[model samples]
Structure formats: structure tokens, C-alpha cells
Target: MNKQLSWLRLAATLVTGALAATGALAEDGPQAEAGSAPPEASAASAARHCVAELAPVNAGARTSAIKQGGCYSSFAAAMAAATDNTVALASESSPESVGESDLAAAATRVIGIDYDGRFYSGSSFIWYARNNFGCFGGRSYTANMPGSFNNRLTSTRGFNGCTRNTSYSGFFQTGFWVRCFPNCLYIGDFMNNQTSSKRWAR
Candidate 1:
């Protein structure tokens, strides 16, 4: 029995090592590189698969880029629920949409991420891939904070985070597991001021 357990442990370790090698775990570091290189085909496949798995999403959008309403719906089901205040913010900086730019004004346009309020309401993040790519978004408040965060994403859309609704915490340590996108994202804490980020491929 001891020997059998040892072998099982070894197998588990090997699997974990392989996952770590493939950028599966999140607690440690950034997944990819600094280059704005395109994603792999396998990534496209994975993205599609994730889309079907996370359906009604229509395979394009990001965290809290929309608003919510209607009867009985998953957050992903409502597409236009968010407004790209971040995009408006970037009218001066990245005004024109570039060629084949899966790279939207904000990563949210590319990857639909949203925060289902837990600790607080109205807190999120955004990354403006222009001006050599910069990520910015932060604040903590009651449900009222959305207005402030909205102005922030709109103001810095040229450059960071946009507000869709009430939230107070980054996507990072929010205790919810979400599939991130091409770029990495850091969701700060509501009160503890903790910042956590996830790096997703494609």
C-alpha cells in the first residue's frame, strides 16, 4: 500500500508540473511575454471551446463591459449590459481601430469579464492597449462608486479601467474563477486593497 501511494503521489506531482509548465496555475507570475505577438491557433480553439462552455456570451466581450436587466439571466447572457466608457475615454489616444485588431480599445472588448459583487459593489479593472499598452482602474465605494469608476474608464479610456456597475474588488482574489484573455488582468481588492491578476492566452 505504501509503495502504491508513493507512485500515485509521483503521478500527481508530474501532472501538476506539466500544468505549471503550460501556465495553468495562477498564484505565482505572468503567463506570457512582453511582446504584442499574436496568439497560437490552439489558443483560438481553446477560446471557441470556452465560448461554447460559457455560452450566450457570443464569443466577444469583457468583464463588466455591459449592464444588467431582464428576467432570469446569467451575467454572460446579457451582452450590451455594459457600455465602453473605456473606449470613449480613448477617443483621443487610440481613436481609430487598427487592422484585424482583436485588440480592442479595452481588453474587455476582447475578453468579456464581469464582477459578480461579493465583498462590495462596483469595483473592477481595465487595460488600455494603446500608448504602448497600459492597465489602470481602481476605487472603493458603496453602490454609488459605479459613476466614479465610469468617469475614470471614460477619462482614461485613452489609457485604463471602465465602470459598468456597482462593484468593489478586483477580479483577482474575488474567489471566482474566470477565464481571462489575451492580456493579463489585475483585479484589486475592495477593502484590503489586495490586487490579484490572471493571465489567459488568446
Candidate 2:
């Protein structure tokens, strides 16, 4: 019985050592797969608000960009769907037609969009003004980058009346300000990957 007990202890020790080694290897392994967002970015993307796509010619025709039965858990995945036109509206709402005036009005609500890659090639974040009221009449839009997105902006586009963008190197619109009027296909070296907060105005 003593010999059997010793054998059992040896087996348990071996198993524990193997598990520890495996865990160490996993910790030292590659953090993420190629072309995949980091775990923190994926989590941030899932936590953000869902995005909707508007028709290029007629913005009033909106479609949900989120997948059916599940939210987009990765910004890259969401951008892929947006680029490939694979997104569909929720089941409760079908596509609808709108008047020309409505389309024109709808087009002016989009304020800005930030991208993680140059020329808008990666994960994207968009901003919209409430009730189509853009940054005008002393109204402005501002926000600090989320934890995962901080220092991640590489490009940006501004539309409607919020064509003036001011990027800051610190949160709360502090630090050196880099101004990009209208749009920036690539935020220059001074501001690229250094933007922690931003503001948009007419």
C-alpha cells in the first residue's frame, strides 16, 4: 500500500509539472494570430456601440452592420463586413425607400470617422451628430480615445459641418494639437499613433 501511494504521488507531480510547462509556453506564445485584433481591442470593439451603414447615394437607407444574433466582437471583423457588403438589417426592419430631400438631409449627420490604418484600411470608429445637427451654432463634438484605441489612430475623415479636426496627444484635448482640416488620409508623424483625444467643430 505504501508503494502504491508513492506511485500515485509521482504521477500527480509529473502531471502538475507538465501543466505548468504548458502554461508557461502558452504565456510566451504569440499574443494573437496574424490579421487578428489584440484581445483588448476585440473586447473594446465588442463593448462599443453598434454601427449602422448608410447608403452612399441615399443615406436615409440605413442597415445594421452587426451580425444577426450576435454583436461584432472584433473591429476588424466589423470592418470586413462593412467593406464586403455582407451586413444586413435586423429582422424586424426591412429596407425602405426615402424621398430625395430625406436622403440629402440624412447625409449631413455623419461627423467623423477614425481608422486604425492609413487610407482607411483597418478597424473604424464613426461619430454622428444628433438630429442631423452637426458641429455648428456653437455646438461641438468631442471624445477621448478608449483604452484600447488610445494611441491607435492612423487616419481620419470628417464630414458634414464637422470638417475641422483637432487631435491632441493627451486626454481631455490637452497636449500638442494637430489640426487636420476636412480630412486626413494619414495623420502625420506628429500625431499618428499619438492621439489620445480629439474634438470636431465647424
Candidate 3:
């Protein structure tokens, strides 16, 4: 009888030990596995990723000479370098429409990027590619923009306004995202890469 009792206790202890081991493993599984990159790393990586994924324009209206400015690894770095009349690009949205030769012409165009669908007037800056590119400020508030972070957005307003709404064909939308406004509207979906913006009003 005592032997049987001893056997039963040993079995229980073994089962308990196995369960405890499993619980511990479960608790540490995520921590042990790879996690999201650091914030600074993520931001830098976004721009790099976008630039790396730049697809060549096969057949359509395209610009030229979009040089890879000093690839700033961080938004702080990009912001420090960001000036008025600069343009941002990303993996999701790149300079396919604007070619290498068109770089000069495209440079004058403040092609900001809007990764997410959010903006505020006269507060946020423009985002060309979420983490991909951080370009110049559209309006007089170029110096009032925020540091690029997570390749998301840096503006409180939708975006700078466009000069004219010139409609084109071939490409449905500009690969990148953007926002526009006559009375301050978020039109990144319908108006991205489709029109010319002036200030962050677009």
C-alpha cells in the first residue's frame, strides 16, 4: 500500500513539474523571440525600406533626377536636413512619376507623404513615405514641423495645399499617400500624387 502511495505521489510531482516548466516557457516565449525594432531604428528603416523598394516607371508620365539626398537614418537627422521645397518618398510611394531628369522640376514641388490618415493645420509637417522619406515643409511653417518618428506623420494639419488639381492617366494613384484641403480635408486616398500642393493645406 505504501509503495502504491509513493508511486502516486511521484506521478503527481512529475505532472506538476512538467506543468510548471510549460508555464515558464510560455511566459518567456515572446520575450525570447524577436520583437519590434527600437523607435529610432524603425524610423530609419522605414525610409531605407521605401527607397530600396523604389520601382522604375515602365510606361506613363514620369519625372526625373530624384537624387537620394544624404539618407538620414533618423527623423532628427532628416529634420535637421529638411528644408523648404524638399520632397519625401517611400517604398509604398516613390518618385516613379518624377524621373531622374525631372529631379530639378520635382524638387520645386513639395511632394509630402502621408502614411496614416491624420493631420492638423499649421502644426504637422509632410511625410512622403511613412518611414520612407521626410521632405520639406510646404508653407511658411517649414521650421514649425515635428521630428520624423516611426515613418508615420509629422504634421497636425492634413498637408500643404496644391497649386492645381491636374488630372492624369495611366497610373490610378501616386504610390505614396497624401492629404489635401480647400476647407481642410483628408484626401490621401483620392488626391495623393494626383494634384500639385502648395502648402500643408493639401
- Measured by lDDT, the strongest candidate is 2
Measured against the true structure, the TM-scores of the candidates, in listed sequence, are 0.18, 0.51, 0.34
Candidates by lDDT, descending order: 2, 3, 1
Off by over 4 Å in 3: 1-5, 8-12, 15-25, 28-62, 70-76, 84-116, 120-162, 165-185, 188-202
Give the whole-model CA lDDT for all candidates, comma-separated. Answer: 0.28, 0.58, 0.34
lDDT (10s digit) by residue, model 2, range 66-173 = 122112545433323433433233332211211123223353355566767787545556554434555655556666666657898888776666668778899868
**Candidate 2: stretches off by over 4 Å:** 1-108
What would the per-residue lDDT of candidate 3 be over residues 1-202, giving only the tens digit for each residue? 9999999999999999999999899878876556768777665455521221111122342432133344444333333233333533332332112222323323333334332223321112333322222232322211111223233332222212322212221223333434333222344445432332222222
Q: Highest TM-score: which candidate?
A: 2
Candidates in descending TM-score order? 2, 3, 1
After the best TM-score superposition of candidate 2, give how far the Cα of residue 20 lies from its true spot, in angstroms. Answer: 26
As for TM-score, the candidate ahead, 1 or 2, is 2
Name the weakest run of 10 consecutive residues (lDDT summed) in model 1: 48-57
